[model samples]
Target: MTETAIAEHGLIGDLQTSALVGTDGSIDWYCCPRFDSPSVFGALLDEHRGGRFRVCPTGTAYTTRQMYYPDSAVLITRFHAEQGVGEVVDFMPPAGEIATGRHRLVRMLRCVRGRMSFGIEVAPRFDYGRRAHTTDVTESGAVFSAGQLALTLHTVREPEDERLARVRVEDGDMRAGLDLVAGQVRGMILESGADGPPREVRVADFQRLFDETVRYWRSWLARCTYLGRWRQVVARSAITLKLMTYAPTGGLVAAPTMALPEQVGGERNWDYRYTWVRDASFSVYALLALGFSGEAERFGVWLGDRIRERAGGAGGPLNIMYRVDGSTDLKEEILDHWSGYRGSRPVRLGNGAAAQLQLDIYGEALDSVFVGDRAGLEIPYRGWLAIREVLDWLAERWDQPEEGIWETRGGRRPFTYGRLMSWVALDRGIRLAMAHGRPAPLERWTRERDAIYEQVMRQGWNEDRQAFVQHYHTEVLDAALLRMPTVGFVAPRDPRWLSTLDAMDAELVTDSLVYRYNPEASPDGLRGQEGTFSLCTFAYISALARAGRLEHARQVFEKMLTYANHVGLYSEEIALTGEQIGNFPQAFTHLSLIDAALTLDDALDGPTGPATGR
Candidate 1:
């Protein structure tokens, strides 16, 4: 509830689940074995009842800085005091492919300079902080016991008298005085003894693990094919997105942590830990364009598998979002007991909107699916069947109104963008069938696509604004509609698209930051204001680049890149004051940035050289 929302950190899960680390070096939020499972450290929602594992500096006059390693998921946080500076390196190795529940979070602490004191606090609140637990420390490590949860901490530093003395004292030097000039690696060990599948950690085992993690990340970075102007910035954002991915299912989440509100003191916070079908499609382009097709291909297979499981004869399609493991059981609830980030009350876990009738996802689905299978990747016949079944379902209901892209609670209007994407889904479906000689109802799909296109062109246009409107009647321009060119709904050079771009520039483009839509002009059923939608801001650059407005696009793209954090990470939205609002390290923002940069590069090189796909 402070000015800065402290204690809100994210965990790097292998896909089964994830953890959230607070600035206090505490794992304040973690749901084991799955992203949407009940919390282990629900302190993010209930500080008193939630479980947390923490390591803190004992000194009072301490300052901290957090950054990820260049082009890697390894996040290193540095703590500096008058005496010395210590760094905690947090990462999950992505090599050798371990099982889901067998995942590990490596927390390495070492003094960077001078001498410093450190303290360790282990509090494990299991089952959303509901179960009682106990703690024990052996010569090997320290273990915490809860109802069905077992957490063990391992390190090279032994339990010395001075180390235990740090518990009561506010400030003092640690037992190990790190020599800054000549670095030393002392062995520390932790063991898990409480229950479950027991595992032991020996200090000697850390060397191989550390080497594997660094090697894994470097190997992954070697796949990047971008040789463009913003290669460094683009690659950093790509690494950030990869870090946010859940490896087990290949289902990349929208973001890492939740309840970080769009407005610091407002109630616009939402949970983003789960995977959305919409995000998968955008990630297809982002991941593929960066020369990382293996992960993208795997994601396509994962999504197809989900469809095979859930595409039951296709009357009404699947839910909008699901657990990282593909479970559709997210039940949203507000945590009234805990005040929210920056006093933004009603801290919530889970998402109710997952069950909302967002008809727009059908379009977002095909956006990624079409591209994923376009360039030599084979989509199964069942996958093709699932795609057709959904489109057929859309043909009958394309005229209906439902929740639009913004997930607005103010009720759905005839959102122009939603209608536009429906057109995309049908169009792409037809194109895919024609390209591969697959069976399809081309007449029906083309009829529906053109029908929707005609209706959108005729009624969605606002004559007064000289641009396409948000819905049928209103003149409010939506930043999402700026993506019309990229989605293939309209050609970039089309006059209508140009006019809409100009209209957005005149209206939504406030210093190159794009608001999702004017909140005042259209109420989204929440109070307070939010920053410019970061996704839309990047989409602006993409739109410009696609239209051959390279000079302007480059300038806008560079400026947007500057808004990224110290380590070149982005979130869903950006506040007016340049703070990253919404979820941290959002996939949507990164994907759009990749899209824009790729387009700019293609523009300069004319597609004959290194870059093959546009």
Candidate 2:
């Protein structure tokens, strides 16, 4: 089985798409055109068949370290050898308000001490390595062409005053050998397109791009109002969230790469390149907390469009997820041509849960709308009517069994988290009506919301466990319920919530890490043992802080920080060995991290312990 430590990587993006750069100086995973597009470099999943681009020291043994540039998405990977130190700076120039088909990955290399010899390799595997590509090499660089898809690599040397490097094409891959002395710099730009002709770029051009990318990031982060103790970490999370967002439509993907295993050698690998309603809604809250009201408002508009598009359709209120452009057709397929990550079989391409009746989305969607409205984003009259209709429709159907928050294929059960979110939807909707003086079925919403609360308190609670269970029929306690306080469903210090936290701490937590639930107690229709969920871990910290357990919360938060990759990026899960697992650079994890940091910071600063926003 081919394997690389999942945590040994950093992320760079242009808002529309992202790439994963391994610590060994290889672009292991990159999807062209867009986040959900076909992979141009899929070596992260199948090392043998999927292609990669590597630039690293070829003549010296070295130790590697990587970090992001302060608050920016730019990543720097340093190689330390006995005789010299070298670094590669990786970043994609941020695409402004305009949408375009061009996407570029820039790599700048320099030797800071002594001397170092470096090697470069560029291999392209189009359409997930199912098609063969032809490479044409010239004095400028090389272009790999497969049908309509083409990737051009442009190389630039310092100047005539410096020693020049030699590049050769071998075995359908571009190879380059260069020796750099101290303060010497070299660069390469990989551009993907259908129309752009291959050409050589000047060092001055690359210098301008680098400077502009840096300026863009610094200016963007300057808008942040978080002057808290955890500012650096919180800012990093914000930048990650921004990186994972689809700039054109303001849709936020759960993560950039897919088919990464939740469990090594397990069949739980999934595609998370699509936008999830639950994740995007929580992201809005995190962005708002960081004083990015424009992002929250734009996302609110996208979400409202989705709701309006599905209203009165046969598809029911809304699907759980959608394509970045709000399309609902996501056909899941297994790629039998490639070996999965770490030999985790059955690599999947698209999400099958898009059509699942995950009713919790309505609650999350309404909550986002409520948050946006509070942040002064106006809701159109038509938008309000569409939201009102969904709430009324939900009142009649919230009691039914459907796919829960986890989207488990085992079977639909009345998940308590689903019920809690349903109540949230109605509650938020009613509040919005009152706050905006909009026409709504206020009495019906209130009655349904109250009924949901009473039913949950009565049936969802497991008397034996002394906590809210995962579903009506199961004794399994889910860490997802950690959001109860944040959503205003229950007081953080309420006995019921405290009991739930205690139960989870005993059952689901391992050294401050949190498992979503015990699949042994409740099978999720997949055969695999998984890692502690990163998002759930953050939720646990937030809940603990809100409950006045500041010391416990602070300690857990600090430990969780250690789990982040060298560049402050987090994946979907963290293994028992403290390695990251599943789809990398997860937006859900980063957003939750922001929420947890903000909640904990407020608690630490205030005279009273964390206020639960009730």
Candidate 3:
């Protein structure tokens, strides 16, 4: 079988974990129980060894089209054949405020018109396809068991006379053949670790689950206050971000899948299933802007707990990233058993960069708290103290650097973006303290904040390059610095920032798609090149809009939208040929898309000139 394009997938989740369903009617990637758990179906990364659950027309020439239900995460894939048209509805029942051991994937099929014949295939590979599993088939369903992990597939077909032999396991995998006329419905449920025998699924039961799932998503989206030009696209981006979040701890993973390479057949693949402070912190304002204050509030609480945990220990202020449960240790490892996506080898898990000291996180963490406060979420006094201690520690250590925001293995330098965010940390901290009448070392924070600003302006800027460079000594421009205006580090219309933007356009922008930095110009320890970053492109659009280039920003934003997948989903990066090249459905990219839309809407609605920076 040919490999599926990374962009040709839609996401569906229960707010705890998500699965990627391809346009060809296959659940190729899914992690059971939790977002970071080992995959039960991993065909997205490896076609042969990694298993898959697929439902499609059999022994016929069919054209496939996939789309999400309006305003919901329910995915529908339609197959048009000479005989008839068949549709498959895929979703996971919403698990609201409750965590369960059992996770179910419900796939319902219907012959919308004429007569259609469809086939079902189920293959389960446990422990990343390293463990072998035994399949057992019964009258009503089939079970694939490997150690403690077991997946049961239950099916029901109409006419009430279809024999069990039609839906039995064949050659170690569940195989089903169904023939249906117009208005006939067939249902299948694949569930993880149930207590008793698989229940007999009925059409009515499938309808109830589908309705409830739709209701859960539509109700959640009803809270959005954005009545803007890009309402539908913005809502889709918001839903994608929400799907990437782990609901239990309020921590959002960068993406659900691991080791989907930025550069195919390169060593750049790293696990993005862990939560990064930088990504989540940048997401707060976007969440709040869409009236999702509850998500922002939960993230603030989760970040506060991490702050308290770090402050109580002898370790530094914070790790760059953590597991969804707020655990600090994420030891990176490679799974050598299964081949990577398109031969992108050394599929990695557990990011090693978690232990690196990226100083910008303090600024991002404090900014998240500030944004949450603005959204009417309050922090406890102890949480405030924890934040205060982080600022105090930062005041002393901001000048030093370990690793930059990109988590480049190429040693650390005094990154200008890192310093810019440090200024943001103290700046926001001082404002929050005075605004709330909270106890903080305001005088010292003020001095440190001003000092850092002066230091960055003096050393970080390069007169020759006519821009704020990537690091203190290099003349390379970084797309990450595009946030300088959005974060209030520099005025949007400041001549210096304008010069920086122009410089970036010359070096980093390729027809409005932005690369993080040119690795050849400023070598980060990595060996291969990467695609243009989606998050950075959105940031570029936001910066352009805030700078009062409304028409140009609008053009860029619309062009970037065309780059999004068929379902309005974005991955971490886009290859030169416009293929999505990194982890699919990245939270950072979607959140930045929301921020860009909000910024552009505000710009288009407001006065013509750039506003003064704070």
Which tens-of-lDDT digit does each residue in 464-488 have in candidate 1? 8989988886889898888777776
lDDT of each: 0.70, 0.88, 0.87
Worst 10 residues of 2 by lDDT: 158-167
Question: RMSD to native for every prediction?
Answer: 4.0, 1.5, 1.5
CA lDDT, candidate 1, residue 93: 53
Evaluated against the true structure, the overall lDDT of model 3 is 0.87
lDDT of candidate model 1 versus the reference: 0.70
Minimum summed lDDT over a 10-residue window in model 1 is located at: 169-178
1 against 3, candidate with superior TM-score: 3
Sort every candidate by lDDT, greatest first: 2, 3, 1
Q: Please give each candidate's TM-score.
A: 0.89, 0.97, 0.98
Q: Where's the lowest-lDDT run of ten residues in candidate 3?
A: 156-165
Score candidate 2 by TM-score against the native: 0.97
Residue lDDT tens for model 3, 1-614: 36688898999998888899998999999988788888989998899888999988888999999999999999999999999999999999876556666888999989999988888789877888878888987777888888888888777654474743366665577777878789988878888867777657777878989999999899999999999999999999998888888888889999999999999888899899988998898778888888988898888888888898888455687888888888866888888877889989888978888888888888888888887887789878998899888999988888886688898988999999999999999999999999999999899999999999999999989999999999987898899899888888888988999999999999999999999999999988988999999999999998998888888899999999999999999999999888899999898999889888888887888877444433
Task: State each candidate's clash count.
Answer: 11, 0, 0
Clashing pairs in 2: none
